[model samples]
Target: METFKIEGNVPLKGEITPQGAKNEALQILCAVLLTPEVVTINNIPDIIDVNKLISLLKNLGVKVTKIAKGSYTFQADAINMEYLESEAFKKEGSSLRGSIMIVGPLLARFGKGYIPKPGGDKIGRRRLDTHFEGLINLGAKFRYNKEDHFYGVESPRLKGATMLLDEASVTGTANIVMAAVLAEGKSAIYNAACEPYLQQLCKMLNRMGAKITGIGSNLLEIEGVTALNGCEHTILPDMIEIGSWIGLAAMTRSEITIKNVSWENLGVIPGTFRKLGITLEQKGDDIYIPAHTDGYEIQNYIDGSILTISDAPWPGFTPDLLSIVLVVATQARGSVLIHQKMFESRLFFVDKLIDMGAKIILCDPHRAVVIGHDFKSQLKATTMSSPDIRAGISLLIAALSAKGTSTIQNIEQIYRGYENIEERLKSLGAKIVSE
Candidate 1:
């Protein structure tokens, strides 16, 4: 039971580097199972969820060697297929959502993949139908055992086929792509998730001798190759962490430089914060946020309607950053509506913001309206419990900009995504201690 004790009213100033993307790391790590050769990965973030996945891989007999601080080499030359049916696997695989991705590569290579019911943040109903159905469409047999709460996919051999996903599900697309990369023929995926995470995975696979085209679009073509070789991959910056830093600077009136951010891949995140009237300077691959001046203001629509900040698929705002946007809006000069379309319960965190002396209206399970205080009324720090990874970071931002010291409990939820968050923020002059 660790908590973060934060002293507010301090402007964080310094250059901080964003770690590798968590979502991408999950997919990339699972892709290692597709080949028996050594796969060297750079810029791996040392976080809880990812480490858990690494442990799961080791349990299945993958040899993972530490190359450096944030680099590792994984070789799956001696995998134990029988371990997938063991109780240890059920206990390990069910802990994180990323474990479900292993099923695709294993099922494609070994003809059988089993996973316990995966667990993750309680943001909303994250369904596994997308992954299972996609694999089934690729000629794999699927089954669900309600008594044991497990999912199984088996196929002696997979044949590629055209399939349209119900939605552009990220992990679902990754699973199907991994399976399709080694199937008998070409596979066309329509309405697929074209987020940078999936694109990087595809690019990495292509580097490892898999045939995949349409890197940055909804329509993807994967021609099944006989075998894939191991290759090195360097992950892009964590976009969610970049957004969090932007919100943190605006909330605390800090002048912080986020170094080496993948500018082109961020996709509307920097511009979205700029719409809130925050000053953003993009120099080369870095983003520099200047200290606050007359506070922040929300830009109105062209037709003079109340401004609304919402999340959509890629090339649109990400749902993961909506919580940070909502927290940032509370300190802006004008009002804006934050709509989280993908996840329902993510908006529930606004209640904690409202209790901190901010004006907020909870419209529904997925929407909230925030009237910016614009620093006229500084938020008073109070004790609160973090509900999820994004909300935890958002609350940490609020606590940093608050009037007094604040405490956030259940920090393990925060550590699941952000690596050494308190230590990193403290380096930027933030007064945060974990205990």
Candidate 2:
């Protein structure tokens, strides 16, 4: 039960590097199972969820070696098939949401994919129907055991087919793509998730001899290959963390430089923050955010209505950053509505903000209206427990901008995504201590 004691009212000023994308790492690591040869990966975030996934790979008899900090090589030549059905596996695989993605590569190579009920942030009903339904659409048999609470899919050989996904679910698309790459014949996936992570996955697979077209679009075309070879991949900088840095800079009136943020792939993140009247300067690959010394304000709609910052699929605003946006809005000069469309319960953490003297109204499970204090009213310190990863970091940003000392417990949730967060924040002049 570690806690973060963050002293508030100090402007954070320094340069910080965003870690490798956790969401991207999950898919790339799972893709390691697609080949028996060594798959080397760089820029791996040493986060709890990633380590748990790596441990799960080790349990499956994949040869994993740490070549360097944030780098690894995986060879899945000797998979232990028996472990997939073991009681220990069921519990371990169910511990993290990313574990479900393993089933896709496993099914592609070994003809069988089984996962126990996967666990993650209790944000809403994150259904596995998309993954299974996509697999089933590709001629795989699916089964769910109520007694053990397990999901399984198997096929002697996957036969490619054209399918339209119900939703452009990120992991679902990745799972299906992994399976489809090794499938026999041609496969076409329409309405697929075109996130940068997914695009990177497609590119890596292509490098490994999988013929995939439509790299950055929703319509993906894959020609089934008999086998895949090993390839090296470097993950993109985490856009979520980049957004967090932007929020922290504004909330604390800090002038900070986020280094090597992969500007081209940021897709509307910078513009979204700019809409909130935050100034950002791009230097080569880095983003320089100056202190909001004049205070920030929300932009209204063209019709003069209150502005709404909502989440959508990639190329649109990311749902992951809506929490950060909400926290940043608290100190702005105007009001904005946060609409979380994908996950329902993510906005529930606004209640905790209210307790800290924030003018936030929980409109529902999916929406919140934040009345920015314009730095006229400083947030009072309070003790709170973290509900999830994104919300925890958002609260940390809020705490740093607050007027007094704040204690945030259950920091383990924060560590699941952000690597060495307290250390990184401290280097950026944020007074956060882990105890």
- Each candidate: what lDDT? 0.94, 0.93
Off by over 4 Å in 2: none
- Per-residue lDDT tens digits of candidate 1, residues 1-435? 999999998988999999999999999999999999999999999999999999999999999999898899999999999999999999999999999999999988889999999988999999989899999999999999999999999999999999999988999999999999999999999999999999999999999999999989999998998889999999999999999999999999999999999998999998899999999998999999999967988999999788988888887899999999999999898899988999889989888988899899999998899999989999999999999999999999999999999999999999999998888999999999988
- Range of the 10 consecutive residues with the lowest summed lDDT in candidate 2: 423-432
TM per candidate: 0.99, 0.99
Worst 10 residues of 1 by lDDT: 304-313
- Candidate 1: C-alpha lDDT: 0.94
* Candidate 1 ranges beyond 4 A from true positions: none
lDDT (10s digit) by residue, model 2, range 1-435: 999998999988999999999999999999999999999999999999999999999999999999999999999999998899999999999999999998888888999999999998989999988899888977889999999999999998998999999999999999999999999999999999999999999999999999999989999999999999999999999999999999999999999999999999999999999988899999999999999998998899999999999999888899999999999999998999999998989998888899999999888888899999999999988899899999999999989998899999999999999999888888888788999
Q: What is residue 194's positional error in candidate 1, in angstroms?
A: 0.5
